[model samples]
Target: MSEAVPLPAGTTLGKSFEYGIDINLGTSAVPEWQPFRRISGFQPTFTPTTQDAQTYDDLGADNSDVTGWSFAIAFNVQVNRNTATGLYLPEIEALLARTRPSAKGEAAVVEVRWYHKPEIGTPNPADAGQGRATVAITRQNTGPNGEIEVLSVTLSGKGPYTEIANPFDGWDSTVAVIGTVGPEGAGDGDLVTITGTGFLGTTGVSIDGASLAATDYTVVSGATIIAALPAGDAGNVPVIVTNAAGASAPHTFTRGA
Candidate 1:
């Protein structure tokens, strides 16, 4: 008999709703990540810290510096019966155990992996992996729906989430937009944050072709920037951040009327 050979499945990349999360709870015997079951949706949030740099002579456009950033993820995982391990109890146990206060009342760190490509057959690049050190579990609740038990968990990042990139990816010279948080669509004068890497010394952030004024945006750091969406027609526009390194790949920002 011939050995079984792997074949390409020709599967399409799925959306965030289709993806799932894997968590590493240090005490577990299995070093392997335990996958969360029946994930309805996974959402990431990025908030940038900025203070108004507007001067008296300026129009008070809210120009600011990118001081720092924080990240969090919110998602729902269903409570399904696992015949072998019993109804996601292990996950619940891990969650409870890791989040419990210690003798000194110190919180534990929970590592999470938000896999962009949830499909097991495809290879996930390190850069695509979102590594978060969860410092706290802000909220958890069950029974949001009619009768089904669903766990809604929110994990706050201990620090800025890191996406390890390959050396050949030109990580040093390129801008990478990892995610955007807050409102999916904003109106004119609304503030939104662009989170990623290589954001230091950003010269400008453009929506479509129009560059935002200096007073309208702030470079929080090399990893974050808070920019107020400029006045524009309601629709989806390409957002590009340019610096001495180079211009980053465009991410869409919708401006509502």
Candidate 2:
């Protein structure tokens, strides 16, 4: 969290839709969450479910019921021009491309978040609210002469869209990512350094289900650990970390052949 700057009196700053936003989307069973990049515009709407309660004979008993709600968000996605792909188009395509006929591939809910300040700026109180919904590509229009190319994406949700929650509040899930493992394809008797977070007081670590002895690993800090690869067959194996908090999602480590 960064220090908050005071806003001047009577000053109104328009929200900048250029950056500081993320969109997470995946299936109902497994969510391959990813943040959106190169976004240009965003608009969200909410709709409520209603039901009639008035009887035909009772005009004075006129009534209606509001039972549930839903929501939608519309936004513009930008495409970069270059010999190679830019920062975002490829990732966006990966998600949208999942809408296939087979059961193995299909579109699912998307989680969207917006940060009013620059992404690198200190975190503010308004930085954590998010919405989730199924998305649809509404239109594609090349911007006016001087503007960048863009795609209009609209996401909608039905049957009880949930209320936005502060993702950082009471967030207990341990999200550990293997940023790098030196000697990436090392063999037995080789030592490796794994760098990541939420590693304080690590209880155990394993490679391919073979537990490494205490002497084999050292908890360098809350963000790092050093361990030796157990002697085993050459192949790819999962690396698991366990602590008082819980086990982290398995990360793949390839062993030398």
Give the best candidate by lDDT. Answer: 1
lDDT of 1 by residue, 16-86 (tens): 55455667554222233456667766787889988778788777666788888888888876666668866
How much is the lDDT of residue 83 in candidate 1?
87
TM-scores, all models, native as reference: 0.46, 0.46
Which runs in model 1 stand beyond 4 Å of their true positions?
1-16, 27-31, 81-87, 99-107, 118-146, 165-257
Clashing pairs in 1: 66-219, 66-220, 67-220, 82-87
Sequence-dependent TM-score of model 2: 0.46
TM-score attained by model 1: 0.46
lDDT for each residue of candidate 2 in 80-118, tens digit (9 for 90 to 100): 544564444554665465344431412465555543433
Model 2 residue 165 CA deviation (Å) reads 4.2
Q: Local distance difference test, per candidate?
A: 0.63, 0.61
**lDDT, candidate 2, at 93:** 62
| Model 2: CA > 4 A from native | 1-21, 25-33, 55-62, 85-90, 98-132, 142-147, 164-257
